[model samples]
Target chain A: MRWRVIGLETHDAYINMALDEAISEGIRTGSSPPTIRFYNWEPGAVSIGYFQGIRDEVNLEVCRELGVDCIRRWTGGGAVYHDSGGELTYSVIAPAGVFPKNIIESYRLICGWIIRGLEILGIEAEFRPVNDILVKDKKISGSAQTRRGGILLQHGTLLYGLDLKTMFSVLNVSRQKITDKMIKSAEERVTCVLMHREAGREEVYEALLKAFTEDKDYGFGAWNRDELVRARELAEKKYKSEEWTFLR
Target chain B: MITHSSRKVKEGKIVKVEVDCEDVIKKLRITGDFFLHPEDVLDDIEKTMVGLKKDVSFETLVIKINDIVKNNDARMIGISPESIAEVLREALK
Candidate 1:
């Protein structure tokens, strides 16, 4: 099936989450086509999994000090630190009926395209079960998905670089686990594109774009006016509000 | 008394359970970073467990949880009925 692709540029955490939800709702109701969008966080952010309690997973003081936004995702998974300068995030909104019915199987199908993208970047990555992309046993990417009303929205981050110190400070890692040796060893468990190649963000983005469009018929598109309006409402009413973010 | 327990399952998926009970379960709140499709099944499970004895057998709890999951057609990934039952047993302990 054909898909519409958009390089959504960068947006803050609330608007980004709102757009994903709004676009998925549009496609679910047949008001828009299935879409693949690439985006980046404006000031970096920490997105906790849907089922997580914000206070339990994040150090809010650290986030505030660093000017990072903290938001909760619509999908269930571990908390992720989206670094503005170190990562690229992409979302795929499609009809759930057109994809695999099994959650894990759909993850594999989507991650396969990311693997191809990594290949073009000269970084060999493998799809680790339950939703992780690994290179030599180090995680390079992680994805999460949610399906509702016949629509599926899957979004994830690809590591271009990692600021381990900042990430550890913002996330809820135990104090006992914070050590030079620990951080050093942690590096062995996570890798990035810059660590392997001399590619910049645009190079990585181009590789992913080529991989997604390669062998498939796709068209460039923009968000519809109604979607922008709905997204703004959702961002202001749901995503940015403490009621929804701290609802747990 | 309010009893609480948290368990980290495979892939670091966490299951945190808090139950209010003295003899029979009065209330339960299950929270964590686990995937459960149509998430409302959590409410159904909590409601079903309200009147259960504090010392309910593990197998019975599992059976009850499975019944709700099946009846609701809920799909749970990373978290399992057994894990939820184990956490419940911990709370009851």
Candidate 2:
């Protein structure tokens, strides 16, 4: 079986999520090849899980004041903040049988790539159960998965340099609960690769690509013209719609 | 037994709700000054939720409550049945 690896530098959150969904749908429907893509979020955005309540998870007023976008993801997980300056996002879309049979095992296997990536950067990170990659007991990466139409899409963000204060401000962390000590504790708990010695964002991205696809043979492929059109339509009709983003 | 404190937002203000469920819902206290039409939607939601298994699917419960609210045209000030279901799901988890 041939695997296709393509890296995109998309900066818009809606476009990024739409492309992932499009690629996954394409692979499942036999319209596109299996793919892995890397991208970033422009401006900034907060993504909540499919079933999450936006009212409970995000401070909409703060986000509006700061000009950050808040959207909901199709996968299940806690809310996450993404910004151009802070994170590297990756998505893997493949047929269900392309990887291992067990779901949890598949998560571990995929997360192994992240672990290896961090290792190359001299940052010791471990894959936590279910779906998180942690370093020193704090999460550096969080992932979510969705399997539909015989295709599995697993995507996540790698924290390059998280803004803890802004994160707390945009998120619904209780103002009373988030004391200075609590903030310090959270800062100490969560870490980013940029905080480590010498490993910059570009370096981390390169390391991740190498870690995930170094041993596996990959071919270059482009989205067919039809796919590009359909993807854009989906982005306009679904990913960018208030109905989809505020479903919960 | 499940116990947790959840924040309820109404008009962008935060209010706290304390819940204690023992096997079934034993106590449902609404502490925040939020308004609900008919003044008993909370009790109705709680009653509908009472005796439900702790492991019951929260989504299903939310759906039921939503149906009830829609049928009665009840107003739930700052809290939605979905939000309540979310809190319950987190507690059970």
Candidate 3:
């Protein structure tokens, strides 16, 4: 089967997420081929899982003060602080029949591509069960998936850099004081490509693309007019609506 | 009246369950960041909980929860039926 690879582009949180749903719907109905998209967030954002309460998961006051966008994802998992220029996000939308039917097994199968991508960058990474990729005992990536109709959409982040202080500030951390030890522990837990070596953005992007396309039949593709229209409509009607973001 | 409680499980997942009962459970709503297979299984589990006796024992609740999850082939990542039952037990108090 031939896969469609949509190259990297940066957009606001609403549009990027809207496109994922719209494209997945196209794949579901056979209007478009299964696709893999690479993208980035422009002004930074915080995306919480589908069922998570934004108030409970995020420091909304800080987010507002800093002009960071906050939204809810269509998939289930923990909250994530997606910093602009700090992360590379990828989405894979395919027919459910193309992957394992079991939830856990499918997560392992899809996350393997992420590990392979890290390997292409000369980084050794391992898949930690249930949707995390670890490099030397520290998390380098996390993914989440959701299945609807006949399509499966999985999207996640691969850190190129991380602003630990900014991230902890936006995310809810019950501790009154974030001690030096706390920061040290966080650094020990999360890692980014920048911490390993100096690498250009394009180089990292190419390595990821190579890892994703290895041993697979794929070619560059663009969203059709119909897909773009649907995405815009969904963005306005669903994703951008306050009711949807705070529905939980 | 409905009673609700939430717990932050060890895995950083939240398990929030709400129960409405007078003598029997009139409603149940389960909401959280936990992943459940097939996605809609939460609705099924909620439906199953409703109409159950309010005084249902912890052991019985656990067995019922396990049966529901197993029968649906539902896998709860970062959250477990035991953790859910713990919340329910606390709400009952």
Candidate 4:
């Protein structure tokens, strides 16, 4: 089995989500090779889970006024905010037969890769089911997965930094449910790698690459021109559409 | 058994769904001004609820439906299960 990994720089949430969908679809339809991608979101955006209600999960008016784009993800999870300086996102696309058959098993198996990556960053992170990576009981990463057309796509984000206040403002945490104690409790439950380590983004990226490639025999490459063109088209035609962005 | 009503906006039009359900499953029929592709996606969602236990936490069922729609690339009229649950919650009130 061969692995293809690509490191992508900052892009908007729409573009990021579109690229992942395009790549996964491409692999499914035999238009592209199975791959892994690392990316960052620019201008910051709030993404709701597929099954979540926009009104219930996010403050849309606030997001509009603040110039933060809100869109729904193709995967199921709670709403999340992604920004350039806040987090690093990764997506892995593999043939279905390459991983475990059970959903939870697959999550654990792939989460092990994240654990290894964080270990390389000198932070001893552990996988916490059903979908989180934590250090000292504070969450450092969260992930979601989908399987289709004999292909598996697992994507996640690792916190490098966070803006909890803005996150709280944009997401629909009941004001009554968010006391000072609750805020402090949330802080205690979540953490960023930059808080504990003095590594730069590039260093962390390299660490993850090394970690993923260490035991497995794989090759690193870039997305071909055709795939890039297809991704851009998909971004323009579907993922970035108002219909899709605002769809609950 | 519980019956609930909720409103949703799809394609700039409002929709009202009336759901009758018990602790084990729900029977839903959506009505209002809206357009949906293939029309069967909604039916599929309703069918998925046939044997589901009402007490089983609607969140998990919604997630399951989301996964199915995403994988099948089904076109939804911008309605989400969360909206349905919200309507149900209000009905319970």
Residue-by-residue lDDT tens digits, candidate 1, A20-129: 99999899778888999999998999999888878878999999999999999888887889999899999999999878999999999998889999999888889997
Q: What is candidate 1's CAPRI-style docking category based on DockQ?
A: medium
Compose the digit string of candidate 1's lDDT tens values, residues B1-93. Answer: 998887775434678788999889989888787888876677788899999999999999999999999998889988899999998899789
* Candidate 1 chain B lowest-lDDT run of ten: B6-15
lDDT minimum window of 10 residues, candidate 3 chain A: A173-182
Q: Cα RMSD to native, each candidate? A: 2.7, 9.9, 3.4, 8.4
Order by TM-score, highest first:
1, 3, 4, 2
lDDT of 3 by residue, A1-248 (tens): 89999999998899899999999889877888999999999899999888677887799999999989998888888788999999999999999898998877888988888788778788989988778898887888999999887798999999999899999899884331124225545556789988886888788888889888889899999999989999999888998899989876
lDDT of 3 by residue, B1-93 (tens): 789887776655678777888888898777776787667677777787788788888887788889999998777887888888888877766
lDDT of 4 at B85: 48
Name the docking class for model 3.
Answer: acceptable
lDDT of 1 at A3: 92
> Which stretches of candidate 4 lie above 4 Å from their native place?
A174-185, B1-43, B47-93
B36-67 in candidate 4: lDDT tens per residue?
33334656766765666656565776686676
The stretch of ten residues in a row with the least summed lDDT in candidate 4 chain A is A173-182
- Candidate 2, A66-140: lDDT as tens digits: 988887776655678897788898888899787786666777888899999999888899988667799887789
Model 2: residues with Cα > 4 Å off, grouped in runs: A174-184, B1-93
